[model samples]
Target: MYAPQADTRLLARALHAERITAGMDVLDVCTGSGALAVLASRLGARVSATDISWRAVMTARLNAARAGQRVQVRHGDLSMPWFGRTFDLVTSNPPYVPARDARPPTWGRSRAWDAGRDGRHVVDRICSHASALLRPRGVLLMVHSSLCDAGATLTRLEDAGLRASVTERARVPFGPVLTERLPWLRAQGLIGAEQDWEELVVIRAERS
Candidate 1:
């Protein structure tokens, strides 16, 4: 399971900032520990959460239970559990870190944050299918590393007829994963030779 980190906190801040009215239907995709899902419930929204990792699903469920929140935690790929159901809001902190391989890992802890090659493996999928999961005027809030091309994300969402833009951003020092892949990241022209920080962005896309 992916641990909640800066990206998670940032997304949570954005969630808290949102005026989530009571009974709003919220779905959190790739929910790690279900922190955001629980928070949504706390804000009076009915919540559901999904994660590719069974461990994460269980963890989220446990967390929600302990918090006395009613969150339906499910084990599934991003947004898969909610097919044919549209939500008022969808939030994700998906795998956006670039990895050496061209394909994402099918199993293991790395699946939580390893986006293959250009780091759009999961992001692109989210962009394409987001519209299907959103009710008209429903919103999607996603967070990822700027290294994965945030502009492309905006364009993709806009192309799908969603008004999208960066809602929040922050610069954080490289974590263990990025620090370990410095040479490769630099070689790929994803970061500056002397750079040690990465900018994380929260994108908000609204379906018309």
Candidate 2:
């Protein structure tokens, strides 16, 4: 299961800032350990969460239970389980690290963070489908590394007909995974030669 990190914390803070009232529905995609889902439920929203890994699903369920919060946690691809349902709010902290592998890992610890080359394997899909999962005027809060290009996310969300912007940003030093990828990232022009940190951004998009 993916442990909560700076990206997750950033998303959680962003979610807490939203005006999520009682009875409002919230969906948390790529819910690694159900932290955000439980938080949303604590805020009085009806929370449902999904993850691609069964381990993560179980972990989320366990966390929710321990928190005394009711979160409907399921094992499925991002947003796949809630196809026909639209929520008042959606949240996600997906895999956004640029990786050596051309395709994201389907199984293993890497599945939690190793996205394809540009680190958008999951981000792009979320951008494409977020609007569809939200009710009119509903909101989507998602966090990702700026290495993937927050600009692209904004463009995609706007093209999806939702008003979007980077609502929060935090610079975090590179961890082991990123530290190992420094040379490749630098060669790919995803980071500056001396860059040892990444800027994480929380994108807020609203359905019109």
lDDT, candidate 1, 43-158, per-residue tens:
99999899999999999999999999999988898988877788999999999999999999999989988999999999999999999999999999999999999999999999
Model 2: pairs clashing at backbone N, Cα or C within 3 Å = none
User: Model 2 segments beyond 4 Å from truth?
Assistant: none
Query: Looking at candidate 1, what is the lDDT of residue 69?
Result: 93
Q: TM-score for model 1?
A: 0.98
Residues 18-43, candidate 2, lDDT per residue (tens digit)?
Answer: 97899999999999988899999999
Per-candidate local distance difference test: 0.94, 0.93
Candidate topping lDDT: 1
